[model samples]
Target: MIMSHLPYLISAYGITLLTVLALWLTTYRRFHQAKNKLDIMKKLNHET
Candidate 1:
């Protein structure tokens, strides 16, 4: 019955959410690191 499949559907939804969150965290970390490097470079350029 369709009602019996509710647990499977819920599990799938949880897995999908975890995957998306992991991907987002990885992307955010890379973006922050890149921004940090840019800031350092800008500071160095101004000093010269």
Candidate 2:
């Protein structure tokens, strides 16, 4: 029956979720870093 494969299915889904979360976190961090750098540059430009 389908019950026999339940564990494998669960593990597969867990791995997929983890992978997606990791990718999202990486992209989010990079975006914030870039935004911060841009803000700093703008502030410096306006000081002249």
Candidate 3:
């Protein structure tokens, strides 16, 4: 494949992909942490 503006295209694609991956990781980490906390809370509540 030939791109007339290879530098610009490469930068754009790299940035876009990185941004998406970062957002996905942030959301996934928050969700996982929240779920872990919720499970711990539930366990504590059950024991009491």
Best first by TM-score, ranked: 2, 3, 1
Over 4 Å off in model 3, which ranges?
none
User: How does each model score on TM-score?
Assistant: 0.87, 0.93, 0.87
In model 1, the Cα lDDT at residue 28 comes to 100
Tell me the deviation in Å of residue 29 in model 2. 0.4
Question: lDDT of each model, Cα atoms only?
Answer: 0.99, 0.99, 0.96
lDDT of 1 at 7: 97
Top-TM-score candidate index: 2
Provide the lowest-lDDT 10-residue window in model 3: 1-10
**Model 2 agreement with the true structure over 1-48: per-residue lDDT tens digits:** 799999999999999999999999999999999999999999999998
Model 2 worst lDDT window (10 residues)? 1-10
Task: Kindly provide the TM-score of model 1 when superposed on the true structure, using C-alpha atoms.
Answer: 0.87
